[model samples]
Target: MRSRNSRLGTAAALAGLIAGTAMAGCSTTGMDASDTITIALAANPTGAFDPYRNREFGISEVAPFTHDSLLYKTPEGEFVSRLAATWKADNTSATFTLTPGITCADGSALTAKDVAAAINFASDAANASWAYGYYTPTAPLTAVGDDASRTVRVTVAQPYGYLLDTVGLLPILCAAGVKDPDSLANRSNGTGPYVVSAVSTGETIELKRRDDYAWGPDGTTVADAPATVVFRQIADETTAANLLLSGDVNIANVSGPNSDRVRAAGLDSADAYTAAAWLNFNQREGRATSDRRVREALVHALDFKEVIAVSTNTHGVAAEGLLVTEPAVCPTNAVAGVLPGQDLERAAKLLDEAGWVLGSDGKRVKDGVPLTLGLRYWTDRSELERPTAELLAARWKAIGVGIEPIGENVGGLVKTLYQTGNFDVYLLGWDLRLGSQFIPYLSGPLPPRGQNFMALDNPEYVKLSAEANATTPPQGCDLWGKAERAVVNDFDLVPISNRVTSLFYRGVTGQLTPVEPTSLRATQ
Candidate 1:
């Protein structure tokens, strides 16, 4: 999970010369070992591996090996310190006490400066990090000092709960030596147990264990340490499961639909509730989806039960909120009455009530304009998106709506379409940590000053989302449930299905399957 910047470096000859010489000093003799483990991710990483590292695919692979955050969530969804030994927070600011004697891979002692630098990098508009949701939450963070007494200070615009959980995952870097933010953003330069040495994006990421590393959750250094960790990108679940079965890889993230196949092949299965598949509607002109009523009608047409059956083989749960299955955000009671099941009769009634009529072409029309919509699905050449889009298009077409399933790279397409305001519908996935992380989608069009693409402006939702952030877990659950019910009643955003990630491993023991609520620290 090393960033592309780490492998690609700079195009200049100066960087080339430095990289060539640095490559000579870096060795991989321990990478190929009988005790070493290899895992496969579903997609290629989108660079940016620092806490500022926004990509989920990269975080899934790299977070376990190279990055150490201030706090990590336990299997029970409780927060514990990782880089910082402890932290104290008040109404305005949070003060952190760094774990003593921490050093980066190159042997430079880690300090408050590195942590501050990583936060600064993530907050930088130029870096475009997805991590700003926690670190720069309408506040400025300042690092206080160096030395063993290194305490960092973070000032908030307003008091909010779950701030610790949000900031806990920001990775610490050696800020003193890092002159290039891009290099640090893309490369492995942290105080974790392992340091990435060689990376071939979409192929393999190689990490070497740090002998001097002594920090761990069990109050001692790891004893049974592997010399190296190799992570490969295997987008195809069947292929990845086969590799794990054949002993090519030690573990692989199998798709929910393919979990039974892996179990049948005699490999162990560990289920992780990480993300969900949801549809994004573009608020733009020349699209039938320009009207909110029309969008609501379209959502009403989707049968989440059928989606779970046909798409996931009943391996996943239907989503009740924008953020799937996280109890703190979309509590057990909140999700119970919110799933969007099929109601074709109700859907037709809504469309007709909205003044859209069945036209000669069998498509819905309003004011002599046919209801034509553009639906872009991920064209990764993998079966993940295309098949789902085909199913969705078929359902929509039957409802007198012209739905076109276009193939495109969904990541960039989402950003591009959002900004251009030219498309109608798109499919995307979101991974929000339990509690406050789910607030962003409800607020919409994040990055603060940016667009809230859905054009959904509800004073009530905004207040409830903030309250959900300001309150503690169980209490927050109650407040968030009310907010979730309000949003569903308004038909703001469509909740598709809660995705279940299945991991197949050969030598792992115990219940690796995660408990209710989701976080990567749980699995490790």
Candidate 2:
């Protein structure tokens, strides 16, 4: 499933990299070695800690610390063993051999039966897991485990590409956590390097390192990891930066103006293209954006280059496609010439042909109704979202289009998009890693039924995506590229810009993975 806070969660993955210069000669020094690491979350977590159920950005931000998957995907895109020491897959089936001596946080031996149960639970549609559509194949599948052989086998009836990539990310729960799922609402029971020690609801989540964790990626253990890692909720970017500089926090994601401040403070930082911020028009019936002409016109109404500068504070690049994460499954540019460039004249002409006549008061009118559109955006996602909304509103207004910029927090925005469906347009970023993850958001039943929040019904995209999903990667990359082009050429969503999320770190050193900190060692 597309994380509810994909934009923020994915960006936070790169937020753990510590610079060597900033941490020089500080290895195991000033701060308590056991209490040295502190991370910042953009917002308070409101969902359960259940990896399969909670897709909140805050939940995802801390997932790597609390959960362990079957395998780990390195920043280089190589799949390494975590719980499963060896794994092999075909188009329709996959087998994983669990590592010996792997145990749960509760000290119970992690057997193949536990792994199979987690898979069966997540893959079952009856459980209504969002992971079913995004992480697992939509087709029927079965998982069986043999404890004696320490093997768990998964088989599908139809050809399903990305079988390994999908299952690799499934955070395997212990037998207890799987049996009493409700107990995982605020606690964790995984074999990861950390365990949830304390939670103050929306304020903070404290994790203590698990010294027994020895089956990490590449056999890394918690030997050098901080004894305690705290994720504190600090909403303001400037505040987060200040805390990092003051040594109140060891890691924080600083974007916009504050990023420069953190950099000047001698903090070591790394940037990742975490998400693609874009404009998604609600294409349900009766919406003005339902007309292809209107969608194209609106896309042509603004200079995206300028929008990118304003929205990202000059730290973003023009988006190439929907997949922004590095080492994308399909490394093809599907958006080069597919989307229309800025053309005010063309926009006006299209709007005119669509029956939105320019009015005397400088607004479009069609059939006695004013052409006003509600442009919704998340207020707290970035310091730039508001200005970006204002910029788009100003540009669209110049073309006789009335835009009402509506600001909401992440929760409010999700409710409006998925449940209320009250807005005409939405401006947000989707932090996605795979091409298949885009299908549920781009097509399928609308909110309360499925996650197709935009209500898009592109027949071409639907057809191409189906063909692409049936084939494995490398072989399916061509079909995936065509499917992405179909979405872009049709202007289903305007790819605005790709933000470079700069994560600032201080007084810490460790292996920096694309998604989170692994084998972290506190230097200060």
Candidate 3:
């Protein structure tokens, strides 16, 4: 756990890691007898293989190997060159020097033309993906200068503080895949470390090392290592952990009761964090939660620390804000003291003032209507969603409000929670790949326009989010912190925990393949 000061010092620390790359160089020669490394993923790719569109969390395990980006972020949170040789930027425009001779899997040359094409294709609104909101260019990002120059110029409508961070992701694809992404199901069209050699739909995904891949991050080549990689989907947590222990699976991500079992087994493990799990309130009309006071009451009624402890088996943090991931330009503790404490007296009073009064049936009522909330939670996403919802129902019941829990399946979570807007209260979360991914939710259009599931239409927030984007990091990112504070102050969002996923490894050589994919290589 690095401190704020250490986070500030990460640029230098990460530089040293990049500078001393040769000593840690990985080899592809020592082929294992099995010649493959198998990992147990949490779920199958629940959506289609459009690299630019909205997809499931399982995509994280697959995409990094198939698509290479211009830049890569070191685990310590600093930018390192990947396909790009050098980068220089200002508030409005940034330039990337595409490395000399990188090639896509089809043996075609990767050029500045390919980079510009991928950005333009994804930035189009008709793509119906999060990238539509993620990359908002007044004019599309284009390739500027001749062949010797080799630079892609990024121009935002205004100053975008996190532009550098955003470009580090987005999976830089060649023209072929961008033209016909559907045809990429069985082939390798990317410039990444591995090629998709085999796919069995939901059962398995296999990738073979790309021998010609020399353009990895931090001046290190990883494509030659670990002859083969395989991802196996095991829906049950206990079963996944057992597979790792029995050598049927080399690695597994375990949480709740299974995490303790993995740790007691004495296998290697590391900490992984994702987006903060939030209690999202649907502010649409015809819902009792449409009232601001009702939303605030729901926030304080639950015992959050205890709820997180019970749900995570004491392996979670009470999230102070949405930006819980570390080493960022914005101060991580900005929302520290803003969250409302769990106080039953305050919750009861707030509901009463909002015209919801206790009745003979023991539930609060407003104009003969009982104050009951329909709660939706993912049934298969985690071992904790149902229990967390049950605990919330119990706590809210003690405060005179009733909650009816509806279990949401994995394949239908997005449609059920965001599209239908059928639930008053729901348990939801996201993975903030570049930190600024949270912007779309604050500004509305719900699912299609953005992931504004709460249907928030805060003009001040919209203004602040835009203002934040118009500045560079440290300054612009600080504005984002202020906007998030405004969101928490209203109690429209209640964060229970910053999810902690523990990855256990048995025969995994060197660094384990991350829960969030990275440019890491095997030592064996």
Candidate 4:
């Protein structure tokens, strides 16, 4: 399988984006008085800052400063104008009228043609843009720009539900960036409130506020925005927290045990939930997990409540569905009772009925082959994953099942799951904001051909998802809910837990709903 990072947001990225640690009694002593905000990134960004390509959570958090979307979704779930002054959309087509006077950092005007070109580049399947699946539907699409009227129109082949939300939010590239493309690999070019002033490779990315920029959500300007925004790469969470406490850094995310200290210290914080962990089985023909009975037996072997607690370091809630991020387009409870509760006897019975018998060594054997499943997990949260894996292994072992834990980094995990297809079960997190986003991962072609890494083929899920996609939101919500439920009920994937990532800030104030750099301003 040709590998591509899954479109869903990974847990490590979410945790790193806003993560920090805390030390009691520490005061903001060395606070900088300049009009600059220093934000700590959990790790250095891997790829380019191209909004159409890089979807890394860390990059997404900072990209807004350099690249402006046509429309912005407010914390209140309302769509507000940014680069686009007005917009309207139907199920498959949308039009956006650009806000006049917007200019790129290079002193060139941002025209309708530039915006349309960005949409076209990102929508083309041959370009392999990450935004292809997340922001736009995989189906063929076209964009036309009427420079005379300052309007850009997009039309999809299928009836996509999120035409406005997805297409409207696509980051527009300037004429220069689109023409060259290669120039945006390490640098940036767009019509936003800030410009990339300097890049120190993996160490730091510095952005300077644009003085003439007047376009922002609801007509907000950069009058109060910091003059310079610095994204400092700090791989260690505790170190990031210490920097926040000392006033060396203004913003950082707090997770794990350190989050409690930050809460106790009464530091200002904003919380957002993301997919922390989930279980997905490889259902290729010969895999043991391909059998529904085995999948159900494994799910029924352990208490999810305890698993959530242990896996999230006691800082998570039971997942309601795949859409855990804030402002989910369809916030329906699709996972309430879809999964079976912990029942050891039922698990054992199901395993036995699947033709797996317990042997002398207390291991399940089917046709003389031991039932040892390869359980893969990302090692970014080894502190929590190790214990969670042990807890799961202990429970499954009691049911005469053996588990071989395989730990890998994010890149390695993607390789094994999407490329090699060597694992049986894998645990990971997903940060998704729309119901339609799950369709590609749930029912599309498998691997190299598509992103359905688990090779799932659920007729009901496929049917419901297609119906849901044929209509617009609110109108399609019911179908989307039923579609997600089908995936859960069939054990295609299990929603393990969702963690609340808190962004702690000191000497700064802004919108926490998303922590937009344009919205942030120095308090000291």
lDDT of 2 at 328: 73
The 0-to-1 C-alpha lDDT of every candidate, in the order given, reads: 0.56, 0.76, 0.64, 0.74
Q: Write the per-residue lDDT of candidate 4 for residues 1-524, one digit (tens) a residue.
A: 01111121123433222112221223334444446777776544555666765545223456677888899987667999999899999877889998889898778998888888888988776775656666777678899999999999999888886877777877777888777767776667888888777666546667788988898997788887788777776656677677776677777766678767877877887766656568888999899999999999999998988898987788878888777666778877878978889998999899999999998888999998999999888765334566777787888888998899877754566578667999898877766777766776787777665668899999999999888888877888899899889998999888888766667888888875566667787877
Please list the Cα RMSD from the true structure of every candidate, rounded to 1 decimal place: 6.9, 4.5, 6.8, 4.9
lDDT of 3 at 242: 78
Q: What is candidate 2's TM-score against the reference?
A: 0.92
A best-first ranking of the candidates according to their TM-score comes to 2, 4, 3, 1
lDDT of 4 at 331: 73
Clashing pairs in 2: none
lDDT string, candidate 1, 1-524, tens digits: 00011101100000010111232223222333323555555444555444444443223545546767776655555666667788887546677778888887667778787777666665554454555553455334444555556787665656666556666556565664345547644467767777767766545666676767666552346445565555565556677667666666656556655667778877766564433346666554455565667777777788777765545546566665544323233343444566455778777877888788987677888898777788876443224557777788888888898888887643454455444554577665444435455444455553334335555555677787777766666667777777766665555555576545565676433323321101111112
Model 4 gets an lDDT of 0.74
Clashing pairs in 1: 50-53
Question: Once model 1 is optimally superposed onto the true structure by TM-score, how far is the C-alpha of residue 366 displaced, in angstroms?
Answer: 3.9
Give one digit per residue, the lDDT tens place, for model 3 in 339-441: 7778888998999999999887779999988888998876555667678888888988988898898886555665765567788987765434333556666
Q: Which candidate is the best by TM-score?
A: 2
CA shift of 364, model 2, Å? 1.9
Clashes of each: 1, 0, 1, 4
Give the range of the ten consecutive residues with the poorest summed lDDT in model 1. 7-16
